[model samples]
Each structure stands twice: as structure tokens, then as C-alpha cells.
Target: MDLFKSFSTLAKAVPLACLAFGAQAETWKYAIEVSQGDIQDLYAQEFKKRIEAKTDGDVKVNIFYGGTLGTSADATELVADGALQFANISLGHLGSFVPEIQLFSIPFILSENNEVNKHLMTDSTTVYQGMEKGFAKTGLRLMSIYSEGEDAWAANRAVRTPEDLNNFKMRILVSPLQVEAFKDLGSSPTPLPFGEVYGALQLKMIDGVGQPISSVYQSNFFEVTDYLISARHQLFTSAIITGDDWFDGLPTERQQLIRDTMTEVTHYMMDEVPRLEQEFLAKILQEKPAMTYISLNEVQRDAFRARAEQTRQKFVQMVGSHGQQVLDGFLAERDRLEQQLN
Candidate 1:
């Protein structure tokens, strides 16, 4: 009887002991705008796994997918306001908060070579030195920016040339650069919130959208649009951001762990995205046999490429001297990285 009582007492005391020592884990929220299995979700999952393991479960990450927490803009604002711990926001959506980031929205700004684009995103001083400061002003830390894949245009009709896009009524992100770029490519760009895209397509409110292959398949955009054009005009980029104040308040070791872990995840995403793009494209075709896939040849691509310089100028004009500095630095870094790869 004494032994039974002692064992029961010990078991009851264990809970009190943990409470007394303050051994409770911290739960952090990570908001992503896409559904599970999308690149952002994949990145979040990998980050959650590594961060939990690294911290020995002292910190836990809860991922909110498909705008459950809110839209991309809402989630980003939450992070900036320190109400949310982390979020994965596309540069397209982020342009509203930090307009200079619209630099990435310029068509064909990144290299067609995936390896060069990967290095540019990971190591470019323009991003860390120039764009990072822009993010800081918004009270968010730019953890890392990574590419999902080249943007593929899905339209109601085939788009072999810029002429085909004339008055096509395309759905574009709410970025001035995108609006200008598509206008230059001869489309009537309609900026719609992401959630409204499918209905907009089904209702003919907009003709089509340009998104990564993974996004088209995952979001079921393949079902709504008739053609998937691999224009490769731009790379779909997303930033993993966190609350600046919250991140800065962390201990030095914790901060380093986060930076190191984010770097690792960025590299993994860069490598994994290309493969996933191909896989997703195959799935889109298999599921929607009637949907046509258009791959623009170099000559055909050049037509769209020719219009890019005009939009690039428009970007600098919209952003001003500071934007000019970032754009110049970005192009220089891109050139240097491309040469190094060669």
C-alpha cells in the first residue's frame, strides 16, 4: 500500500514539477496563402520539421494554409504588426507593402537558366543589402526569397505572339510593374485578389493568369483555362518573412539558428522547385487532356522579351532613384552570377 501511494504521488508531482520549472513549449504560427503540397507549403513543412528538431521541441510551428489565416496581404501585415510570427508571401503580393520589390515583377528580369536564377535569389547582395532594408522599414525581416518556377501563362486562347494577347483581358497581380508589363505585351490586365481568380476565370471576368506550373495544378486553374503557355517571362518568387521586432528580441543563439535554418530551406526549395514544376506540369496534362500546352521557342520568346525593356523602364520610373539603385545593383549581381556559373 505504501509503495502504490508513493508511485501515484510521484506521477502527480511530475505535472507540478514541469509547471514549476516553466517547461511549456512556445507555439508559433506560420501563414501561407497556398494549399498543402504547393511550394510554399513544402517550404513551410521542411522549416517546421528542422526548426522543431533543432530546438528540441521547445518551439512548435503551426502552419495555416490556403488563406485560412488570411489573404497574403493580410498575413504579411500581421507579420509586420507582430501579430503573426511568420508568413510566406509572394513578391507579387508583397509589392503593395514594399513597392521596390516590384523589381522582380519586371518580365524576364531573371535569367532563363535555373542555376543562375537560384544563385541570384540566394546570394545576391542586391536582395540582402538593398531589398532587405526595404523590408525592414515595414517591420518585417526578410528571411529569404526563393523561386517556385518560371511563370506559365494560361489563357482562353493560344498566345504564340504578343499580338495574340491584345485585349485578352488577363488577370495579373496587383503590382504596377505587372500591369505595365502586361500592357506592353498588349493585354488588358485586370488585378484581382488571388481568391477571386477561379471565379473570375469561370465568369470571363478575366481571360487568364500567369502562375507557376505547380500553382496551376494545385489551385485547379488548369481546369478553368484552355491553354498553358510556357512563356518563361518571369520567375515566381516568394519571400519567407517574420516579425522584425519579434525576431530581434530573440536570443543571439536563437536568431542564428533561424537564419541558418532558413538558408538551408532556401537551398532545398531552389533545388526541389524545378523538379516539382515538371512533375506538376505532367499531372496537369494527364488530368486535363484537352488543355493545350504551348512552349514558346527562342524566336517567339524574343517578341515578349523585346517588350520587357519598356516595362523595366516603367519600374524604375515608378520606384524612383532608390528603385533605380536596387534595379541596377540587381542586374549587375545577376550578370556576375551568370558568368560565375558559366
Candidate 2:
């Protein structure tokens, strides 16, 4: 009788111990607007892996991909409300919430040189210092901003000059700056949801889209488009963000771990992007042999560059003096980085 009672007590204690262990583990929810294997997904996965490993499984990240939880806008709100722990959203989409973010959408604002652009995105004070307060005001902790690739135009027709884009209905992010920028280039800018882009192109709802080369290939936009124009007008930048309150509530050590891990991931992404751009473009061509690739010469690109000033003026007008200050700082940083690189 004594032995049986001891055995029963041991079984009960074992389950209690297991329950306590499970209760101590933390599960963080991460949201991304792209499907698995996309650049953002890769970033989220790497972050999840690093955090979990560093925490020794005390923290686990559950990623909700392809807007499984909701759209990018919805996910942003969820993060701000503390319903989600993290989200990777493009600056274009974020412009609606924080208009100052539109600085990034201005035409040719970033350097064409990959190294300069990488440093601007990763290490620039304009983003980490200048824009951090704007993000915090909206209840988000801006963790890191990184680029996927230079934004390219995928169209049904070849475009070599600004005149070639006349009346070209282009699918743009729902950003006022993008609308004005494309308008300056003589294209009718149509703001559409990212998911609806491929179908809209197939159904002829829009003419072309400006996106990173990887997105064009990963989303299979190449199937519906005929030409890939290497415009290099802007870099496709995305930010990793979390709820301001949630991040602040964490222990100081955990916060430092997250910051350090994100910096590592940012560097990882910068290195991976150049290789991915080449691989994705090759795959796009292999699958679409009839597709044309157009690389505009400097003289041809100079035409588009001239019109960028008009868009920059419009950006300052929309965001006002604060926007101008941020823009000035960003331009100064870009210039410094370019000079250093040269």
C-alpha cells in the first residue's frame, strides 16, 4: 500500500513539473506579409532561430506568413496593440501610418551603389536616430531596416526613357509619394494591394509594377509581365518592428539580445540580397525565355533623375518642415556614405 501511494505521488509530481516548465516558456508571434521563402520570411526565420537559440528555448517564435493573420496594415495595428509580438513591413506600406516614412519612396533618394545603400539602410543615423521617434509615436519599436534589392519595373512593354512610360498604368504602393513620383515620370499610378498585383496584371487591371527583382520572381510576376526594366530608382526597404510597450517591458538583457540578433540578421540579409538578385533574375529568364531585360544607360537614366526633384519637392510639401529635416539628414548621410565608398 505504501509503495503504490509513493508511485502515484511521483506520477502526479512529474505532470506538475512538466506543466511548470511549459508555463515558463514564452511564445512570441511574428507576422510577415510575404509567403514562406520570401526575403522577409527569411529574415523572420533567422530572427526566430537566433532568439530561440540564445534563450535556450525559453522563447519560441511563431511566424504568421503571407498575411495569414491579416494584411500588412492590419498586422501593423496588431503589433501596436500588442496582439502580435513582431512584424516585418515595407516602408511603402508603413507610409500610410507614418507619413515621414515617405522619404524613402522619393525617386532616386538612395545610392545606386549596393555597399553605400546597404550602409544607409543598416547603419545610417537618419533611420535609426531620426526616424525612431516617429515610429515610437505610433506605438512601434523600429528594430531594423534593411533592403532586399533595387526596385525594378516589370512591364508588358520595354521602357528605355521617361517618354516610353507615357500613359503607362503602373501598379504602385498606396503611397502618395509613389503616386507623384510615377506621375512625374508620366505613368498613371494605380495603388493596389500587393497580393492582388499578379492577378491584376493577368487581368490587365494594371500595366506594370515596381518591385524588388526578388519579389518580381518570387511572386511570379514574371509570368504576367514581358519586360524587366533595371531602373534602379529605389531600394526595396523593409523594417522589422515590435510593439513599443512590449519591447520596453522586456528585461534589459533580452532587449539587448534582440538588438544584437537583429544587427546580425541585417548583415546576413545584405550579403544574401546581391546573390539572390542574380539567382532570381536568372530563374525569371529561364522560366520566361521570351521576357526582355532592359538596362537604361546613364544618359537615359539622367532623364528620370531630372524629374526626381519635382517629386522631392512634393514630398516636403506633404510632410512639411519635419519631413524636410529628415530628408536633409538622409541625403547628407547618403552623400557621406557615397563619398566614403568612392
Model 2 earns a TM-score of 0.92
TM-score of each: 0.92, 0.92
Give the per-residue lDDT of model 1 (tens digit) for 1-342: 999999999999999998879877889899988888898899999999999999999999999987697777789889988888989888887887778888888888997676787677766788877777778888988888888888888778899999999889988888877889899988999988888898888887888998889999988998999999998888888888899999999999999998898888888888898899999999999999999999999999999999888997888888887777888899998888788887
lDDT measured at residue 108 in model 2 versus the true structure, 0 to 100: 88
- Regions more than 4 Å wrong, model 2: 1-24
Backbone clashes under 3 angstroms, per model: 0, 0
Q: Per-model C-alpha lDDT, please? A: 0.87, 0.87
Residue pair clashes in candidate 1: none
Could you tell me which 10 consecutive residues in candidate 1 have the lowest summed lDDT?
114-123
